[model samples]
Target: MEKKIKPCIDNEQILKQRFLALRDTLDLLSGKWRFCILLNLHYHQKLRFKDFFEVSEGISPKVLTSELATLEAHQLIQKKVEYTPTKDITYYVLTTHAQEIWTVLNTLIEFGLSNRQEVIRSFHSDKN
Candidate 1:
């Protein structure tokens, strides 16, 4: 006996909504350094502009400033300024909303690890 599966009545509309949602998410997260910056914040909790530049190797001060502004504008990260006798220091910290991205980041890390292993294996096989 063959079993029949029923599809949702609003399948097309649901698919469209999901597609748009994914597109929006990608647009928000798109860029070479966004994820890297987010990951550093996730692990470090907070970082200053100079700290990011030092840790993110290869990222220029201008690009880091731009990316930090974008993240702050999106509400994914918050910028804090401390006034001191010596100078004002600024730091960036991830928002609670940004915690949701850990799940996505973990999934990406897993996929990347698996893909890297596969690529290495393929390269070795090709060498044979």
Candidate 2:
């Protein structure tokens, strides 16, 4: 049996609120390196400034600095400095405030994979 899909409706205020929320999310993660940095920190737990360059090729020091600053400002990540005996190291880690983003990130991952399949299919169809 085929299932029926319900049509959803929202009031003006609700639409505005939803738009603002999405805008805020995009503002926080909008950048070439923001999502990549988030992904790395999620998997690695913590990472030093220099470590980003290793995982993300073709990224410059300036861009990384800018992206890190934005993430820090938005409270998506925290920066910690460690000083041992001879050297000081700075690490970037996720903050509790931004923990909610993990759910959004997972949704994005699924959307990305599904979109990739569609793109590949379209490309193959175009070639035929």
Candidate 3:
């Protein structure tokens, strides 16, 4: 059996506000690298600029820098700078705010797994 997902706030008058909330969530999670970055932080906990290469291939430094900035602006991740004896190291870590997103990601994983075959079939048929 499949689990049914429902909105937490189901009041009629607040539907407009709920849609606005959804838009805000999408704005933060919209870009290519933000979701990937969040998932990376979820697993790895802390990452340096160089570490993103392992997170996702073909992420250029310019794009990574921009995505990191957006994520930080939304409080999804934190940018930390560390000074060692000889060098300054920068790292990114998931913020407490990301815990809720982590739950959503896990739920999405399950949904994808359950729906993969039908989704693939639908895509293939659409191209025919």
Candidate 4:
């Protein structure tokens, strides 16, 4: 008979803390449009409200406004108002802190691509 080792309390606490952090991160990023909006900002560097509406496709103006407000509140993005002779143009740009998300986003993209391939393979196998 083999004796099983008990889990350490410190390890359990660390795991719990990690899970809580993950939950907090998900809470902040939760929503279809947030990731899309962030990705657009990453690529474009800066964009106006109308630009988001055009690029994000399928997102309503109301929801975009809300999401942008949330991101701004969280300090993930900055809202810049450019005063001009004609009018004030509002542009959204990512904060320096937002750069931290690049690694997470890239990892998610790789995982998604791998998962899609696996799902396609499984579907094909089931058909046969």
Q: What ranges in model 1 sit over 4 Å off?
A: 1-10, 83-86
Per-model C-alpha lDDT, please? Answer: 0.93, 0.88, 0.89, 0.94
Candidate 2 stretches with Cα past 4 Å from truth are 1-10, 125-128
Scanning candidate 4 in windows of ten residues, the lowest lDDT window is 4-13
Cα lDDT, model 1, residue 32? 90
Model 3, position 26: C-alpha lDDT score: 88
Candidate 4: global Cα-lDDT?
A: 0.94
lDDT per residue (tens digit) for residues 7-63 in model 2: 364466777788899898887788778998988889898999888888888899999
Name the top lDDT candidate. 4
Better of 1 and 4 by lDDT: 4
**Higher TM-score: candidate 1 or 3?**
1
Mind giving the per-residue lDDT tens digits that candidate 3 earns over 1-128? 99976767777569878889999998878877888999989999999999999878989999999999988988889999999999999999999988889888898888988799889999999999
Clashing pairs in 3: none
* lDDT score, candidate 3, position 40: 89
Clashes of each: 0, 0, 0, 0
